[model samples]
Target chain A: MTARIATITSGKGGVGKTTATANLGVALASAGFRVVCIDGDIGLRNLDVVMGLENRIVYDLVDIIEGRCKLRQALIKDKRLSDLYLIPAAQTRDKTAVSPQDMIRVVKDLKPDFDWVLIDSPAGIERGFRNAVAPADLVLIVTNPEVSAVRDADRIIGLVEAEEKGPPKLIVNRVKPEMVKRGDMLSTGDILDVLAIELIGVVPEDEIVTVATNQGSPAALDPRSRAGKAFREIARRMNGEDVPFESLESKDGFFGRISRMVRPGGA
Target chain B: MNSGLAVKGVGESLLIHVPAGPWDEVLASLLQTVVDGGEFFHGAKLGLQLEDRELGAADLGRLRDQLAERGVNLWAVLATAQGTRSAAADLGLALDMGRPSQRAMQPDEPIETELPGDAAVLVRRTLRSGHHVHFAGHVVVLGDVNPGAEIIAGGDVIVWGRLRGVVHAGAGGDQDSVVCALDLAPTQLRIAGQIAVSPERRGAAQPEMARLRDGQLVAEKWIDEHRR
Candidate 1:
């Protein structure tokens, strides 16, 4: 099956781009689809670590591009999933080491083997970001529910359109359901109003996500995780399945109700 | 007398270098030259290039105020003089052209053909954030101009959709040039020399026309009867 190259980018840093990439890759692969995740951040590599495939990496994206290793050799197989793989970025190299055309070529080579290739773009609208999106058939802009993150998402969406890699989809990550209910945080509607792009998924803020990430395991591996369920739904949607968005009220459950009753106006 | 002043179009704006001489007399002559030009050089972005003249903060600030009072925008101050450059930098005027000029010749005749003019190109898609449209003639966009996108045209511009980006019309030297749109609320609008921003719309949007009026940029509703 030909791979659909999807790049996840956020203009601002530490907004869960690498986390989303790892989770989405795992979620897609677990559904019996062949998936590969590429860490586009050159000098600062994190996708490999996030996916927990750091130690297995013998060759990397730069090696593949530089002809030092075969593309298959660069593909580090995940310990948990046979179909899931990662082409880690070299920590010593900078963004200029790999060009946009090199990325396009690498993705083209993987297109024949994998069903989906998710690229984790570096923060800022610079060379690394361009390289990440160069081969993307679809772009997913990740943003938090804050004003600055939303604004950066808007900017990234614009750049995506400029490069003709649009129209990009948006994933609003780290959304606190209680805050949204209290009207303290920007809701899905508020984000869609400003961005004007198609909404792909809204990953709610879950403590499990933090714990799972710390353990170098994506939240998607846990079936009981709320964020994991959201990611699975996103993967299905990406595969052309029409999955309805999870209702926020149902997400909170009884524990959420108790907290809301006690705090009343807590964010 | 403002006899020694030599003005020329550098990029999209006029450049007037303040030659090393008596400050008081040169300033007077420069102001007189601007006044003599009537509406020709009014509301222009003038870059004063000082090669070696030292200027203090108060001197630069006073000059900026004086230029602003006369409808001129002091956008840049090019100086080889350390003190002058520092003063200008403190005032936040650009020291150099960060990017090369994207300039071309203006169209002499209106292009009514379907092929469009050689200077400008018509865009039929929405200009989202980060999209930039640069043309040598008038730009006619049939879609929305979102924030962060920019349009630079050498002639008048017409948008059949919402305009919110930074647009500079009449990039050549036609002062009577205008910009029209279905909803003409730009982040910033430039016509020949004058620059202005769209006032916040009270309610619904209507077809509007923007032009220089009394040396100031103004926007008015476009009526079908006033096609002429």
Candidate 2:
């Protein structure tokens, strides 16, 4: 199977790129696709903890890229999904330890067997970000509803476009329905109007996501989590399934519309 | 086949030296070069030097249409062929590059002054956070200037789209310089020695210009009163 390399990047930190990458890998694998998630944040390794594979990583991405071990030996298989895998990053080395060409060669080796290769990009538009997107067939930019987050997402989108990786799809994470209903937060429409890209998923804010993350299990594996459900739909969309988006705004939809009309223009 | 296309920056526009050969092959390679180049050709005016290559009106029209689709304006056509020259005339294109003295040998060199007095730099894309656009001349942006970004210009600053970032216009201590944007909501505005923050927006977005009025920075609607 030819793997589609999708890099999840956010120009700002703490925007849930790792969570989305882990969840997408789980959801895609749950759907019977062979998925491998690579934590591109080398020094700040966390995908292993999010995927519950931290203890099993004997050889990290640096090891494999540095030719210390075979590609198969470094892949830590997920306990829940037989087909899902985790290629954790080195915790000690900085982003300089790996290069874009190294990522391309490593991804090339993993391409023959996997259906999907998801990369968790680090924050900032620097060497780490470049390493993640170098081998990507598609890019998924993750951003929150805040102005700061959306602004960084715009920067990341520009860089991705500059790299000629095609237009990256957006995943707006941590939307609070209540806040949106109360006219206190930026709506999906507002973000879309600014970014002007295709929306693949909109994950609502849920405390269970934090709980699930701390538990070392992706929420996408849980049947009851709302954010998990959003990620599952993202995975389905990645698999070429036409799943309708869940309504994140209040049912009235009137408050959101009025807020858009009266929102401050410049400042 | 790929040698048929030579794309380079000349002053503010791009000059393409179109080599003579099979039209189809050269056209394919030319299109490929622009597409693969990425983010460089957007909003750029193109001058094609088609030497000794005769072309019909329809063929010239097709070329113009293709370049236009990619946000490139075909401003001039330099051709020695008489038929190609007339076809270009029918299309309202300039035949000569006009003195050719303004042609910059190095792409990234500061633009030689062409305006009556002031020099300017044109940026065609959004400058996101962490982006710092520093220029010695006036600056013009066709896209948004998001927060956390900074634009330092030696002269006036103009943004066709939103301007929410910090801008230091007239950085060379010219207090007479001005800053204009479609949406003037900069986090902080600096003109020479003066500094001011944008007042909170009250209503819908409108073009606004900021300048030093009696030693104080004021932003007003870009109307007939504020004509450049």
Which candidate tops lDDT? Answer: 2
Local error of candidate 2 at residue A67 (angstroms): 2.2
TM-score of 2: 0.70
Output the worst ten-in-a-row residue range by lDDT, candidate 2 chain A. A258-267
Clashing pairs for predicted structure model 1, backbone only: none
Report lDDT (Cα) of residue B122, candidate 2.
90
Which lDDT tens digits does candidate 1 get at residues A1-267?
A: 899999999899988999999999999999999999999999899888878877887888899999999999999889899999999999989999999999999999999999999999999999999999999999999999987788788788878888998589878899887887778988777676567777778888998888988888999999999988888988998888867665656656422443333233221
Best by DockQ: 1
DockQ of 1: 0.30
Candidates in order have lDDT scores of 0.83, 0.87
> Residues A186-223, candidate 2, lDDT per residue (tens digit)?
98887876776777888989888999999989999899
